[model samples]
Target: MREMTIGKNDAGQRLDKFLQKALPSLPPSLMHKYVRLKRIKCNGKRCQTSDRLTEGDVLSLYINDEFFQPVKEEEAFRRITPRLHILYEDDHILLCDKRPGMVVHEDDQGTLDTLINHIKAYLYEKGEWDPDKEQSFTPALCNRIDRYTGGIVMAAKTAEGLRVLNEKIRLHQVQKFYLCLVHGTPSPRQAVIQDTLLKDSKQNQVRVVKKNTPGARTASMSYKVLQSRGKLSLVECELFTGRTHQIRVQLSHRGWPLVGDTKYGTMERNRPYGMTHQALYSYKLHFSQEGDWGELSYLRGKTFQVEDVPFLPFFYNQPKN
Candidate 1:
């Protein structure tokens, strides 16, 4: 028999959901059976599987000791040396500047040194996270950037933080700004590009298309030419709708291919710069004042930005304000 007390991080989860996370060895069928048999009780009383747990609630499990034993798995983060460029951090969240070539999560390549892993390692070393103590929750990234595109990625330190930030992002309450160097200056310095995009999963690419096309979705972004040097132009873009490679595909369709973007631009255009990956960076983030942020209320109306972008120095000696 074992008793567990719900903490703030573990609250608000359904009884069945909590059981599945707290006792991975227990089969789902058996768990339901146990609940029916009064083997599981909340506050010493029988509880339903759908009952939501709250902070300070206690759960008593009258089951086999074997089910409580922890599962053995490789914790790859332990072996990785944490390397992160922190832009902002608080008790509920963290903003990390992920560099190019770093995978945000594990991919087909079986890479171990990933951005999330580094975050875990960093938090573990700081004593903010312990996998053994957490039955279900782990530090998680709220958004993801491509492996080649460097940017500021948000990490949630708590379950409530993750839920709130995800909702804000979905509602377009969180604004994201990006910087990229393109081969040619945009004719109309500033404008919004709106079009439907169809993605080819097999090819891992996207293309602009007419509306109502099969599997096509709307994509939009507003961009401005910040500076012009020779034939290249520095552009700042804000995403109105996030599609797969939306900025790259939309701009390239309008004859303004991003520098070093071999997938969307001609080899001759990228060869002059001797570049491989696209010169794009998610440099700034702003949180809207409208909405209930829960524990993350402090982040409302706040803005965080990355000062140094890897490709920015090469284009201009002085930094852009």
Candidate 2:
């Protein structure tokens, strides 16, 4: 049995929806079964799956406490696959490529082997940072990229570096740019999307509102057409405000969702490779930190992308000898 206390962030969701968001790997049918069997109870009482839960409610889940035995095939693949590709690194910052189909981090599992873990490992491998508890180290990643989106990431090596970088970002000294392949060309080649977003805790989904709503936060981004290939229009995006799913939501709202983004794009547009992760890549970052502002007036960069994939041919042009 596992005990869970509802936090303010999860207050407005249905019991089943909350369970799904909390335990992503567990199937919904199994979660419902536990609810029906009263194996899952809220406040020590049987609650239906549809029961609405508020903040401060205590939930108890009765589960089989069995050790996870890895399947041979899954283990074999897991061993072969490495997450997070390193693009560029220095004493102050590290750049990496985020891959699709991989969650950057698991909120519940809290494993040490996510993209963030590999990043630290990459740092240690280069003899730049020591992650050992015995030695003093610095915090990393001035910002994190979403798992579904492929792009460049910036990480700080020293605590001082982190502080300076964070301040610069807050002051809008850093610029981030992305390359996305969308289905349609936006009416205006260059335009800004300004809207408010509210996250639905129970459904684990976010809603974009044009007007004021509870807990809504403003988001803004600009897009420009780069190149068009067949049905796909390659576009460049720049963010003025960082918000969850800002690019996806804004593009989808404009009827030009990124290619392969089933969550935001229409099924009709998901063709060729149906329902694949959106072909979005973070291509550039410009930073102006305080401490090393003199030595490095601005840090401009790019990350290495895997060349094995056919979709990435345009970016990887040189022949490896």
The predictions' CA RMSDs to the true structure, in order, are 2.6, 13.6
What stretches of model 1 exceed 4 Å from their correct place? 317-321
TM-score of 1: 0.92
TM-score on alpha carbons, each prediction: 0.92, 0.64
For model 2, how does the per-residue alpha-carbon lDDT over 69-160 read when each residue is reduced to its tens digit? Answer: 21222212133234556676666666776666555554565444566666655555666655333112334577777777766666777554
For model 2, name the residue pairs that clash.
13-202, 151-282
Q: Which digits, one per residue and each the tens of the lDDT, describe model 1 over residues 1-321?
A: 889999888898899998888888999999999999999999999999999999999989999999988778789999988999999999989999999999999988799999999999999999999997887788999998888999999999988888898899999999999999998889899998899999998898999998899989999899999998877899999998878888899999999998999889999988978878999999999999997988888998999999899998778843333
- In order, candidate lDDTs are 0.91, 0.67
